[model samples]
Target: MKTKYQITTFLIALTLLFNSLQLKATNTIIEPDSDKDKLIIYILRNILTRSHYVVKDINDDFSEYVYNEFINGLDPNKRYFTQDDLKEFSKYKYKIDDQLLNEDISFYNLVYSRFQSKIKNAKSYYGGLLAQSFNFRKNENIDVDYEKMPFAKNENELIDYWRKQLKLSTLARIQSKTEKQNAALEKDPKTKVKSFKELEKESRLEVLKSMDELYYRIEELENDDWFSTFLNSVVGAFDPHSTYMPANIKERFDQDMSGKLEGIGARLVQKGVFTHVYELVSGGPAWKQGELEPEDIILEVAQGNEEPLDIVGMRLDDAIKFIKGKKGTEVRLTVKKKLDGSTKVISIIRDVVELEETFVKSSIVEKDGKKFGVIDLPKFYISFDDENYRDSAKDMEQEIERLKGEGVTGLIIDLRNNGGGSLKTAIEISGLFIDKGPIVQVKYRDQDPIIKEDVDPKVQWDGSVVLLVNEFSASASEIFAAAMQDYGRAVVMGGNQTYGKGTVQSVLPINQFTKFDEDLGAIKMTIQKFYRINGGTTQIEGVYSDIAMPNKYSYMKFGERDLEGALPWDKVKRANYNQTNSYQNFADVISNSKKRIAENKKFNLINEYAKWLKENQDDTVFSLNYKSFAEEKSNQEKEVEKFDTVFDYTSNLTFTSPTYELPSLKEDPVLADKRVAWHKSLSQDIYISEALNVLSELKMNNTYNAIVKH
Candidate 1:
């Protein structure tokens, strides 16, 4: 199933499956004698260029590894693709030669053209959606249930629906031109004489510039991964931590591993091809400037301190390259600020952000005379620094030591929002609690099995452990949780199920050595799949907890099986793990927790709030004239304001002085009221309160045998 998770791919259209590559500049050509030989030579050149990375030489090891990984996700019973096709792919295995790909523009154009036709079919819908989603991704008006869309079931309807999607998106762009002209008029007072029609025309032209956005998306992955990343990126951006990375994104995974990242400690996105800063990282260079912020339009990049170069139509990769640099370098950015509506140049210095700060601060949860240490592992931490290698093993070790000193009785490792990373580190970290043994097994297609075992014979904290995960916990997170659950060492608790990704990915660099060909570089194909020690697979069917909790996310449907081309569930030979005799009874502990939570007034109120939140998760469209829309929006806004005051206390603290007539967090105007309010809500974190109750239950149960188990 792990193999299946990484390998599920669906070709959108029959034409796309076998379409000929397109071209942009076809001014020159050679004598056409050996077209076939030329193509073969081109393939070889492309392969060798990228074939220089780890596990190069295209040896049997690389070939076999690629074969197993890719095949594990394949459907063998169906002969949709023949062995001959497999052989053809083998010849170009682990390679995409530069020479072969020098100017393969035709391929891109073909894909783009086919995709763009859909946009033309429905103009207004595409334009409208684009206008709304672009300006405010938070704008729920553009939301659509893909399963409910007409195109989801019938191919003919699907094409037309997408055409409308494009139209609405494009229309949205047209609305922005008015903003530009209004600005021009404000500045010069001479560029006037513009009516609403004229303004609309200007916006349409500017918006037309982004028509290629969706086209580029379809051409890039051909729907194979377009939908896969849709959920993770689209929704994940709502909260800084949530996101989805399908098994198909090896290149992105490799980028994260490379220690070089983009976005200037911020997030960039395209709601409708108009790229903008989604959010600024706290304490980031951009954040320090107090200039760049969420929803700021990135108009241009100026290298060094030079004149800004326009980048409106640039590729996302190119935009990213322009932003990232050595840790100490500086980059000046020209941004069209959304708030106060101004344009400004902000220069920022690059810096590394510690991932730990993004996570919850560690604290000891005491209940009924027992102590339980709780730590939220947001994502896998395996930084590529030389001395400060941020492996989960080392970090958890330090945390364990600290928690031990705090004199905690049990441990609750929260894996929520931890999408996954560094499988190697996950195994090593899991090994910390359990003695040396097989933690997880990975089986591939027609190949010998490879089992990843924690070599450490030493155990760190063998006390009662509880792992909290949600639908977002995936890959390495799943690996650790599954091993602990399979061994009956820890109780897995969270929402419906964890993200069912159980495959391991190895990033292969396509053009690592070339200084000239900057445009090249595709990350590796998936290399292998990971399985748990038990018989069941963690592929599409993620790990279900011993006890499920109510989550605010309800519109969120269950199971990856709902996804088209999603890899089906399968099983391989299971490995063995011995359950520790010292393991505490989790059922009893859970029962106590349930009783406590049911009686807790705060938790009950939170449950009611969570139920209210579920009904509002889906984005819905609204008209400017709808009274109900205004009322609903107004009511929600009021509720948020009230909750905002409540949220302030739980997550923040206020410091008021003798001169203060009102409470405030800081003297600064921007940080005064809201910050003060946020501090107030810090005490009202209902979910955290529930977790505290569980910790208390574990404490009373394990106090006698509280010391770390060895």
Candidate 2:
């Protein structure tokens, strides 16, 4: 995706630096030398085979393709091509192969001669379609009839007739073209009236229509699975990374790369063709309006409140089509909520769940009316677009600067759900909080390690720092979190550990590619491993939080370490950094923070919810009764809804007749067996609460004491 960085600098050097290898050959692929020639020819022929797309030509230009592609080029607006080493690749730009053994070359030439006959046959196909428009019986070899066959006994039986016809058509086209090409090439120049160049170009053009027909027919056939696998095999010869991700694989790819889409923001899955909601993102639209819960089965969808279309057996993508609409325009989801572990319908309106909804929030925790800065650094995000701006990094920089301006003596940088982004931004942001030093070290393939450093030595708001992380903070987030912990810039706190993702990736966009049918998307392959400045590796084994807290997200089978092909962790020499003076004995300060939470009824509520989650992780079954089920589901929703509600810990707000306050959270949240999870995050959340406490402490430590000041 980044055009500035090019792969194969070797190719670039060859054109300018290497002066001896350049040589030309008569008719086949030539190269600077023999070994490279073999590799080049093998690569070129196959690349052209895959990239040559066919649509009815707009101009019927009759231009030479090799020139059009390599010299003359495809349309200039189609910027699929990057500047290649023209001098280095000049010898290899050719269409025909002449270096094969006499027998193979002769056969190849013969097959090319009859390729035109197939093209002529293709013209008849268009004529057939046009003739049908005028009600003419054109090609009477087979009568085209449309009567549904008797219901087949099975799936295999239904495909039998269609499969045989496709097979016949495929074989006839390939055979005819092969016979003609080989036949034409065998004749002497005297026998062939056209010059060698003209004859060769004509030969290639002749095969174009046939190649187009064969490729299309194979793709359009009934046996998509078999044909797709075959196409993969053909493409596989190029490289391991070249792949065709089918629809199913593409779905997972989209989810992994970008979890947000223009939808209800509820996680769902298809269970026996019925789409069911598994979880609702906290603060999302469905969670905003009360009554939606886990185990809600979607029965229908209405686009902008249109007719509620039943999606009982629709595929996941099809269901998404019915759910997603233009932002701000509403979509009505008729959900079958599980009541008492049984299903019932509940409707909800969909709207965009802005990142602003998930951003670090603040509240003035008044114990004797003292205020402290609570800054949640969800993730170190980079602006995704080079055009428009404002991402986590830029906005976070402004937030920290604002807190500094706000006279907050201490800050909390929360790093939960922050999967990381722009590596460049991470280092720049890390530089903001600390003096200049190495933020992260990267080791590339066969290259020495590169230390990405922050040059700015001036610190911003250096009163006291506390960073918050959970099992989900990863990748670039780990880099900043680990460095801050190692440098003692912040007292890092979280559950047992952060998510381990110590690998660095560089995305490679392929050469000689086009934005045609089935785009060859960029591949983000792992090219390096990352190491922290204090001789630690954050792969699989993530950086541990200095102050541990209780976590509800069970780490048993999740995170980057659990994934296949994850790179192993390793360490490098430590980078020099100046540790800051202790603003306070934060260990005792954190103890007091935990004490405040444990004593508060709110923290205790979190613990109750954790135990509930543990007991019911595999609790995924529900029933279909209407009345009793609905009531049962409502009660369970109350429990889940109370899992993190701050009001659950206190009798601060009594239940009003209308069920007052934010619908997303209720006061005096469920007091039963599910209220202990308040401490779920707070118990292990030493860095977060400590941040609150330390900010108050730092205000006292600074000359600007008695009030919040950095």
Candidate 3:
């Protein structure tokens, strides 16, 4: 009787009814104050599950993923949560998906409350540990890779772990101070060097101060920060790239995208208990005021006619908020100059500051009787609000034209450290090199792939080209490199692979779909995956360099594939496009370059340095004994001295801008100085020199082929 179709249908209905009841029972009611966040959660779920490229169900499997990822992200070092805490949390590991579907945040509340308690306890542990003077003679070592260790069994174990970490940090600081004081005394006989005991006391005081500041900052975390982390964990469960941006974080992103800021215009970093000036914007309020300088430690910040607040022990972001005021508002800063420990109060009015250094710049490098152009594009930046904004493609085209007028024989597009932007711009930039064809193919869920092409037949430069990239070059940068490599338009050179980001993200503002009075931030979701015209996706495998050079980061494992929960690599049908036969003997050319690099002294040095770096990084266990730590550091320094000659190599090349840029360079001293520095570095770069040689080889090879044809 149960085998009948009617019996099967009844069983299915019973299971569904049970799940429905469970969903209702698990539903949580958010507080009235958090109604807006609850609404945002609802909207985000719909967007991610419905509009995202990959649709997934909020079930037990998904709940387990969110729970594990959230906990791991919070306690990356396993220093906070104990074994008992994790055991308790494991109960809701598979139940979180139900809670999320029902808009219940009881799990988040419970975890976050426990997290706060742990942090408070951690603060006490650090305080007690630092209150005791560390023994430098102790023969002990600490594990830097704390992730490999298990969670503490109890409070006693956690306290012991904290003590070891604190001891390690204290030893490092003491070693650094000892070396600095010894060098100072050696340089000047009149300068008095403190005794070892005195130096130890100073190091302890500095470490304690830093720990206090760090804990103070942690204690200041509001509900918004914790909520953002929780929401991000949910979004991140989908993919590494997709995430929710809270209102405050989104505001900073908007400013960075616009390349404009209203502030004192000085970059600051927390050094011990003080916020030290890293750099001053060339044309910003701080530089114009002419009082603030790099390495100056800011002590206090004051608003107009208001009492100054001590910023020495304050968090960097909080200190910055105090220093940054609206346009035309006067903010005062109490600073201490590093060169001479003299305190000075500088007052300045904030104004709109636009960063000019983040733009297209080109320098003409004359090498081996041939002139070549190098265009360094820091980022593929464009303004969505401003239609007439000068984007990477438009500016790059102009830089090429200028370089062409300078009679350069070849071009190099240096996209090193360029974290990509603007997919449209990447396609347009790729088109500038080729005559006209499909640039990249974008595939959305359950839809035919969309082919983006350049209908314009005009080729920007029809000559030997080389594109330079590094591990950090990603997204749009990979797109351009892949297109060029596919079409043989440029010789891709640099690290082994480009950053393998081959996904497209679209920002969805939460308030757009609803009439919410409160500001609900945006969520950037991956909507499509992109592929090269040749059909291969650059997801995890990234575009491989045609000529791989030995790099300092050769040992570092930073790639898309290295990221957790990253999408896998796949291929689609290749777009119909013509492969340019520009370089007929490309393989022979690469082989020859490899041979040359093998014999080059600088390349060998680089290879050795990379190996040494890997060994050093893999060594996670560091000695806490002052003598052993000092000896290890000293050996590292000596090894570094061997590679000093790596930068000593120089090319007999002259660098200059085109005639059109000279007039502007003359007027802007800052711009001229930057150009000079760029040229100086280029001259010292062995990689660029080799790239120039490759261009020369290509030109010679072309000439030989032409003679044979004749």
Candidate 4:
């Protein structure tokens, strides 16, 4: 007789044996062909079925998932598609799996065609609807719970739906204009206030212009773009993390992972018809030039001394094409400043802009005369193209050394909103805290779990540590936090739990698999699942906080468990590791923190605010009548005022950069301004204040008395 592990393995093998036979049958149904779309489907189907962590069979259930995902992707708000279109599209609801096997694109083609037609029809509907004045005085309400909303029955009903949406938009604008006019008149008795009729007409024109811009962007999408959307729908059925990326998207994804981009060093966002500068990268060329600022609208773009090309009403992507150029190239932008509504031409030399926010940043704070260090890691970033390039682990180690030089007693590693990056860096970072131990266990399909250990014996920071995390802390972040928590190395503090993403994905180039000349893009496929060293998987049940804190997302459904089709949480054999037993009074420290939080008025208010947010999120119906809408808006503002003190709360601690960074801050005023804003925000962060308190209470064991020895 076999042992339990062997028996379980044998059963899994037997199930896969049968599934392999079905896969073979499906493989015989279609051979790789010249058609790119069908070829992509073939490649994705094979890769997902064979290599994915969870083996989901291509059956009616999978087909239904793809169908719903595609339809929802096209018309999420149930705006464009009518019930008749859905009915026609539902014919292939259970046939998608068969179509995939047969290398057929009939369903996708049909849906895409119908969606295009609906978009065209919607343009006319919005234009006609916004041209006429909306009778906001009519007593009516609109339910915005679009997920459960039924599609319109006919063309007339569809037009009526558009009318309601446009009416809601126009009503909001009218209300805002009326309030501003009233305030102007109140401020100055001689102020010329526009009449209700004039404001209403102005609001309609604004709404109409917004709709036109939206339709123009929609019309700019090529057939390949829509096809990519359909392909993503198919791959997404396997898991939420698995996705298909076209060539352009893959390029941007690479840039994001590398935390570098070649441009004017300003982030842009399209509003109405113009692209506005959202932010300037600190220390970048634009920031150095000191001409471009956030909220400045780029009206036109010119290369060097060439004639300016008007970019107003241009597609944001098209505008970016003109704005971004090779390094050392000059690009002049005609800008409308947000400060004084003044038009000015600013020229700047483009260069490689490093996104400073993507890396590790540390601040020193003094609490009761004991200096504590806070490291805010946005992501576990790494440059995959070059091994010698900067990574989070190296930066973290250097920052720890600097803080140690500063004689800081305790350290807080903030991983809040850090959707994790490199797994290598996470393991390396974990090693900085512990001498040597297993960090995480990776398990792929049909293979024994492999334990990834930190073989390094040197501990970087042998002191009291506090790890801060929120619901957005995921993947590599969760792994590092879990390792520290398991080893009793740090006090994990944050929301109830983390983002609960335990799976690993590898981006594979589609062109590599085939002899194709064109760039076929890539696929990010989930290949493995990670488990904590203690044998518990951080799949659905993320690493729970040792000391839970109240946050705005506290009562929200934001973790992986809240998502559909997430992998089930399971365990494997525990990896061999030793607990550091570093904290002497860990239990007492947690108890004291809990007691203080229980009586804290601000925390209680935050909890109440979280509940109120949940209530508002659940309420989707709104009155469309002008009088009721205004009253509801007034009531909301009044109610929101009760929570206004949340922003006013500040800690007594003072945060500053390390001595090494002071020289750079003095050189770059933009960088100095950014640090000032960050320090200000940290001073107002109640969570960090609590973390510092916990850090103060923690007492290290004599066995690990490195910090005390220093």
lDDT of 2 at 393: 57
Regions more than 4 Å wrong, model 3: 1-34, 189-193, 256-316, 319-354, 700-710
Residue range 1-710, candidate 4, lDDT tens digits: 00011112423543464355345433653344457787778767776787677778999998999898888877866778888888888999999999998879999999999988888888789888888888888999988777788889988888888888789878877987898888998999899988888999999987787677667867887877778878888888888778898887666555542233348777676543468885566546786687786668897788998856767656567888999898999999989765434357899999877577567899999987789999988778776658899999999999999999999999999988677778888999999998887999988887888999999888899989999998878889999999999988999999999989999776767665555567878888777788999999999888999999988778876778987888889999999988888989999999999999989999999888888778776777778999999998899779879999864688777899999999999999967987897898889889999999999988889877754244
The CA lDDT at 626 in model 2 is 24
Q: Point to the candidate with the largest lDDT.
A: 4
What is the total number of backbone clashes in candidate 2? 41
User: How well is each residue in 1-710 modelled by candidate 1, as lDDT tens digits?
Assistant: 11122213321221221121111111223233424223322322333332211123434443344333333222111112234434544553433222224423232233234334533543444455445323222333322333232213343444344444444433443434444676888898888657755544554444444544433433444333323222222222122122233332334444442232363676676432346875454435565555676667786677777645555545455677788776778888877664322346789887665443443334454466666676656556665545475566677877787777767777878787566766767888888877778888766434555778988777787666778887767888888999888866777877768878755533323222122222222323334456778766787888987766655432354345444334457777777666654445567777876676567555455455555555554433432222343455557667656444322214222222112213432445544543343333323544455555555555323532343332
Evaluate model 2: give its lDDT.
0.48
Model 3: per-residue lDDT, tens digit, 673-694? 7678678878888888888878
Candidate 2: minimum summed lDDT over ten consecutive residues — where? Answer: 652-661
Question: TM-score of model 2 relative to the true fold?
Answer: 0.52
lDDT of 4 at 54: 77
Q: Candidate 1, which ten residues in sequence have the lowest lDDT sum?
A: 17-26
| Per-model tally of clashing residue pairs | 55, 41, 0, 0
TM-score of each: 0.56, 0.52, 0.82, 0.83
* Top TM-score prediction, candidate number: 4
> What is the C-alpha lDDT profile of model 2 across 434-498, one tens digit per residue?
65788888765455667889887666655677777877677888888888877666777776688
Looking at model 4, residue 428 earns an lDDT score of 99
